[model samples]
Target: MACSGCYSVNFMAVSSNPNKPLTSSTLLTSKLSSSYSQIPFSSLNFNSKLSRIQLHKSNTAPNSFVVVSGIKAEPLKVMISGAPASGKGTQCELITKKYDLVHIAAGDLLRAEVAAGTENGRRAKECMEKGQLVPDEIVVTMVKERLSQPDSQEKGWLLDGYPRSSSQATALKGFGFEPHIFILLDVPEEILVERVVGRRLDPVTGKIYHLKYSPPETEEIAARLTQRFDDTEEKVKLRLLTHNKNVEAVLSMYEDVTVRVDGSLSKEDVYTKIDTVLRNVLGQRQAAIVLLVFPCDMFGISTA
Candidate 1:
């Protein structure tokens, strides 16, 4: 069904299960090597052969949007998925620093709205205070407005902790900002629980530390450490269960574009695997299309 209001929405899903053969249309749409040969770029004097491409950056990070052969690269729209304490926050920070992409956490955006006392935020707060999930329309609307920001439109953005359900994913596509890639961090439940329950936050510097793996530097620092109320084991377990239920369905929707990483490895090792997947994706670069979809406040909700 099409979304109400000014937005028009269409969604496409790709199958990436290696054991099963893809259908005719799925094969055609897949970004695999076989499909690239079928692109009609050859008639335009463009190379059909995939080549290794390096990302170049200017002095300023935002100014470093990818440019290849005079064609500006499409903004990198990525969504990172993981269970609680799966190290998504750490990885996102690393990715943003390395690639200069805007990082938008769904929770943060919602929190900011509530803090600013917007109408949507008020509605969201009611549900949140009751420990209920926020409605998809509210979340999707806020996300649409966020992506319409100048920095997000130009430099590209990485989304974290949004679209946990298939419906939420569809709603995002309805907003015309479907992610180009999906990164899933697969960690054992045991490990995830341990990571979450053992986590500590520095009240002063705001740095995260694990009680066992990455404790404070000294006893003095440890004394100053504080754990969030939600860091308890019961909370972690409930959060994980909620995450598992929603993420399984969402992952299926992006099978072709999904990069599953084993999150049990060391932080650096996990990052290495993620970096490799990103490099491979960027290597098979598509012809660029710079879309200022929401420029000039052309798309969003009606205040009235």
Candidate 2:
């Protein structure tokens, strides 16, 4: 799983206050507190405790970030699972911005291949035309290809809407591509079905909007918006049922690392919860590697 794009930060000690930037002297002299006991670091282990998260924001809006001590032996890898209309896309965008991760939507990749008329696309298209689920191997192949790209290998990835079944999850692990963290968004069935009713997709950008909550801003955008054939309440119900069944199997494989959040919450709230989880995961110690997080002043020291 090693790649040219991987980045590793090595630190001998950590500063508990992210706002107070760590100095070379601090690195050589800081002591580990009883609460933040020194935990052995490893490349892929998430068992180590997160050192600290300090946030700073302006009065009008929160534009600050949390910094902590952590290490990543490999690029960040994340997976998302949720019922239809559970705000997965929105959260993915936030996570990408916060973590600088590649947003690898499996459905989007398949759609692109089909649109390009590639062999895999043709095969998948034929299967879909017959109302059959596209085979897992085809989907997995496309995913592997996408992940192998330089951007994904370097920046890491946020995998959306793949590995629906236990076998598919196993295939991912078989390739040594198991996610560092598996996120599950929990929403009420009623809310999910209701959201589906107003859903709209822009074929050009692949961005979705809700007619009531977030309509297209311009007339041109609205005119080009299209609804999926399966957006109906009945369809939503069926999809939800099927997804729950698959997720049960999938979750079993990721129980130790899975973090579930309430998708019914407001967008900001949901993102905040997810952000906290990822920060904690990233802060985990490994191989005596201390990831020093500095409170981003937006114009301050660039971690990038």
Query: Clash totals for all models, in order?
Result: 0, 5
Taking all chains together, the TM-score of candidate 2 against the true structure is: 0.69
Question: What TM-score fits each model?
Answer: 0.65, 0.69
Best by TM-score: 2
The local distance difference test score of model 2 is 0.71
> Could you say which candidate leads in lDDT?
2
For model 2, what is the error of residue 75's alpha carbon versus the real structure, in angstroms, after optimal superposition?
2.1
Q: Give the TM-score of candidate 1.
A: 0.65
Residue clash pairs of candidate 1: none
* Candidate 1 local Cα displacement, residue 16, angstroms: 38
lDDT tens digits by residue: candidate 2, 1-304: 1212212234322333322333333332212221121212221123233443333221222233333454336777999989878989889999998899999988678777788999998887775444345688899888888888999988899999777788888888888788889999999998998898899999889889899989998999999999875687776776777788788999999999899999999999999999998888777723446554333433242323
Residue 117, model 1, lDDT: 100
